[model samples]
Target chain A: MELLCLEMDTVIRARPDPNLLYDERVLQSLLTIEERFLPQCSYFKCVQKDIQPFMRRMVATWMLEVCEEQKCEEEVFPLAMNYLDRFLAVVPTRKCNLQLLGAVCMFLASKLKETRPLTAEKLCIYTDNSIKPQELLEWELVVLGKLKWNLAAVTPNDFIEHIMRKLPLPKEKLALIRKHVQTFIALCATDFNFAMYPPSMIATGSFGAAICGLQLDNGDQSLWGDNLTDLLAKITNTEVDCLKACQEQIERVLVSSLREGRRQQQQQQQEQAGPRSKALDELDQSSTPTDVRDIDL
Target chain B: MCRTMSINLSKRILTALSNGPTRRNLFGPVDREQLQLEYQDSLRKDLEDASRRWGFDFLTETPLEGGDFQWEGISGTKVPALYRSCMVGAVEVLRPRGASGLGSAAAQSGKENIPRTPNRDSLKPQSLEKTPEKTQSNNQSNKLKRKQTNITDFYQAKRRVVATPRKSGQ
Candidate 1:
């Protein structure tokens, strides 16, 4: 007799252990070490001469697109950005090598975070093969060496669950809250200004912005305005004044990125002569980032 | 099912990537020779820095003069069988590749054996930044297990490099 074999091949993710997410020590320890992992300096001023801030944004946007298209775990993009920031903090990389560095960062982060890590071949293809697989592998060691072999640096994403578990968010909107928080976090990663901020602050700021965007803070006084900032600051041990500034920065970034995304989308539509309907534009506005001209920060 | 979904996903990626703006190279053509030269220079500088900081020559697997670390090497026999990648006994060839397991980042690297040189690059990129005191006294056996070999050797170990208090992480 022949037997039919059957086993689902879905990615096996561990359930969030309460021991990790709920334990006070886990959260506190994360806050303590989060600063240690931030890039050592505002690299554009001192360490880098050939590369500009805009170049970093260009690579970051591409990296985010790759992560999104490949369905990489949420932490992978942020974690890779951490490595990129840290490496740039030290190494004066040439502009020509920046994309190679980005690919190497993604390659390392995927290996660290994914069940099936992305192959070097695949990453090269994503760069339109501007970089070879051999180059990616060779640079991986150089990047690793500069990182001091510390691949486990704490990222803002680490604080998400720790912060969320403490928030008074409605149970039904937990998933939506997480989605927005992650999007905000990714946006911050792409921006160079947030590069030097503590991961906990970014996580805290993203949480504040995310909560506001989804309007999940309705009917709760403790979750509104200054009160919400105080609550978030308390959770992450960030100063209230600083947390307010970071959240405002995040909001500004969201508006600008939304505009940038739309500008590109509109250009593409014009080239094809397929004018997008206003109804569709409004629908799109509800979802993507905007970098419009008139949004006041 | 996941495989089929990935196949569909990859197919979509292939078509979009042909002329997709997302797929273009950001920085024009790279000077491959200069990049390779820089890679070599950077690796040499890193090894020298490691040597000075640890007081051990990682390239030679030996101690250096006037270094922070006091280097001592026990014979392979002196080290426990568990720490050795291949035991001297019958288990040499048959050891499962996953023996190092996950989170053991690059543990057992041969990369540490590359020949070293004095620093060559005039552009000292990150020398200005201060390295904090190496506070964490990581266990000896733990350090030996997940060490890096050359880039070509292994991707076997998982979380080999834990985020310890050692800021510069050499």
Candidate 2:
């Protein structure tokens, strides 16, 4: 009876404090304006021989899975990917070390974003014990050094909340749109093709894509007219043409990502294993033993 | 030829410094305990402040760890340099064992043995301007007195060296 009373007496304080909400101007300033912060490498032209575009995708997927499994904060994975991309831009890392790099980046990012940061031991476990805590500790410095220790360099997720706040939608629809935007942002993180675009552009484009997808699913195109586009472009300070191009790319990836996710889900069911088992197997198969040996040199 | 020769000379000096008695193994095991206590005394407040305000954590929070301390929070434009400087400062004041070990090999390490010889090359111009002729002469005389002994002798006698007679770090 006492335990039941204590359970009933528990107070819920799960919601964010309204007083600590960020100022709109601060959010706008947090958006990456200068091209200096963007990664220099593209899919066609990369300085690192070992780190190909697909490798980035695989690592991003792994990071996303880890974040989801651990129930990390919303901003952790994208911020981690930002650090990974920026670090890879300047430093040519080995393929074997790529997963270690990813783990360390997320470790750094979670520290920055999560109240309870991901532990080094847990991150090593997630890597299937391929790396150790000491290795992660060492590479954290290397990644931080290569990134010039600029861990808070802006990411698309930074602008998502700001953009969502500006849209004229009800609370329920706004929540739905926000969810879609997060998916689009994650998809963009995996693809190196999106690296060239500014984070603001990506955020704006992802938001636009989300609205379109949500509206179409509800059989309502009225919410996505020219006025809405203009409003989004104006809010993000993006040109309409560039915004359209980015939105198109985002939608394209969103479709394929959805399909790929579904296919993987089916495969996991067939294999009767955890979601990560097949992906890890694919990663091992893709990087042949000879390739690993070549990277070590 | 001179540049290469200077490089080789510096390299030999560095190797010598590397092989010298470190604070860790100086008194054998007890030195480490003293060094750890000193490190905590000097760095405790600053580390706690940095950890609370900026989310930075000490590298020694875990055992058998190497490299710079990790940080959290939104990293600022000046943060990397600030963090490096803070670590450098902590290292300067407390003299961590790992940093001493690596500082010998990574020639760019700015923190090791700063009290003994304060990077006269970089400090020359500013110090020359700041320090008057009389003190400068006194420093030179002191160096002459100190130079009769080898660098190792200086290293050995460093703990007993006083700050009032010669402002070495300054």
Best by DockQ: 1
Compute each candidate's TM-score over C-alphas. 0.72, 0.54
User: Worst ten-residue run, lDDT, model 2 chain A?
Assistant: A288-297
Q: Which portions of model 1 miss their true places by more than 4 Å?
A: A1-7, A272-297, B1-19, B57-63, B66-74, B80-170
lDDT by residue (A63-168, candidate 2, tens digit) is 7767766767767877898888787876665676678778899999987776556778778777767676766776676666567677776788778767777777
Residue lDDT tens for model 1, A221-263: 8888788899999998899999989998988876665555455
| lDDT scores in order | 0.75, 0.61
Q: Which structure among the candidates has the greatest lDDT?
A: 1
* Candidate 2 docking quality: incorrect, acceptable, medium or high: incorrect
Give one digit per residue, the lDDT tens place, for model 1 in B79-163.
6555664443424332232223211322222111122221324213342121111111124435765684745453333223343
How far off is residue A127 in model 2, in Å?
1.0
TM-score of chain A of each: 0.90, 0.79
Among all windows of 10 consecutive residues in model 1 chain A, the one with the lowest summed lDDT is A288-297
Task: Report clash pairs, candidate 2.
Answer: none
